[model samples]
Target: MILEAVMLQVKEGMESKYEEAFREASKIISSMNGYISHELQRCMEVKGKYLLLVQWETLEDHTVGFRNSNEYQEWKKQLHHFYDPFPIVEHFSRVML
Candidate 1:
């Protein structure tokens, strides 16, 4: 599986709205092809900071499949506005060792 990780820093005072929007946006991501699972975690020490972890069957599932779909536009509409400077997304794979 491929793991997608993102560090999100929301705009000040928009945390609650962002979370609510994320809840709605979750459906979009969850319905994508090859999506395994995902979780969003808030940082205890930093307000408006969140960690997003998503598991996919393959990296292309997220990078190409999802990102290029119509649903991605909806996802972006719901949650993209909340980011302060935009989040950086990275992917990883499990090591056999």
Candidate 2:
């Protein structure tokens, strides 16, 4: 499995609206191929900060299958405007110790 992490900085006073928009956008992501699950966490120290974590079966499932799909456009339309400087997304895999 792969984990996709994003640190989101929402525009001031748009937290509630962003959450609502994310709720709708969540459906779009959940329906995509190779999607495992996802979670959105609000930051305790920062007022307009959030952490978005998503699980996928493979890297291509997100970087290719999802990002390249039409659903992503809708996802962007719904939640992109709420961001201030935009978020950087990173993917990770488990490491054996």
Candidate 3:
């Protein structure tokens, strides 16, 4: 499985709104192909910081299948504007050590 991680910095005074939008946006992501699971976490130290973790069957499932789909546009519409500088997404696999 591939793990997609994103560090999100929400715009000031928009944390609650972001969370509500994310709850709706989650439906869009969870319905995509190769989607396994996802979670959104809030940071204790930072007021506007959040961590988004998603599990996919493969990298393309996210980078291509999801990102390139029409649903992605909806996803962006639902949650993208809440971001300040925009989030950077990265993928990972198990170390298997």
Candidate 4:
């Protein structure tokens, strides 16, 4: 499986709204091809920092199949406003784990 990790640094007092927006945006990603699963984890030490993890069957499925679709635009609109300085998303494959 391929894992897409997105790190979000939400501004203070905007956590709730960010989370709500993500909740809606996730549905869009989930409906796309190669989507395996999705999970969001919050940082215990950093109040507004969060990790958004998405599992996919292949890299092309996410980078080409899903992102190329019209759905990505809607997802971006719904969730982009929450970022203070935008998140950097990276992908990885399970080499050992």
lDDT string for model 3 (54-87, tens) is: 9999999999999999999999999999998888
TM-score of each: 0.97, 0.97, 0.97, 0.93
Pairs clashing within candidate 4? none
Clashing pairs for predicted structure model 1, backbone only: none
Candidate 2: where is the Cα deviation over 4 Å?
Answer: none
lDDT of each: 0.96, 0.96, 0.96, 0.90
lDDT of 3: 0.96
Name the TM-score of candidate 1. Answer: 0.97
Of the two candidates 2 and 4, the one with more favorable TM-score, higher being better, is 2
Q: Candidate 2: deviation at residue 3, Å?
A: 0.2
lDDT for model 1, please. Answer: 0.96
Off by over 4 Å in 3: none
Q: If the candidates were sorted by their TM-score against the true structure, best first, what order would they fall in?
A: 3, 2, 1, 4
Model 1, 11-39: lDDT tens digits are: 99999998999998999999999999999
In candidate 3, position 93 carries an lDDT of 99
Clashes (backbone N, CA, C under 3 Å), per candidate, total 0, 0, 0, 0
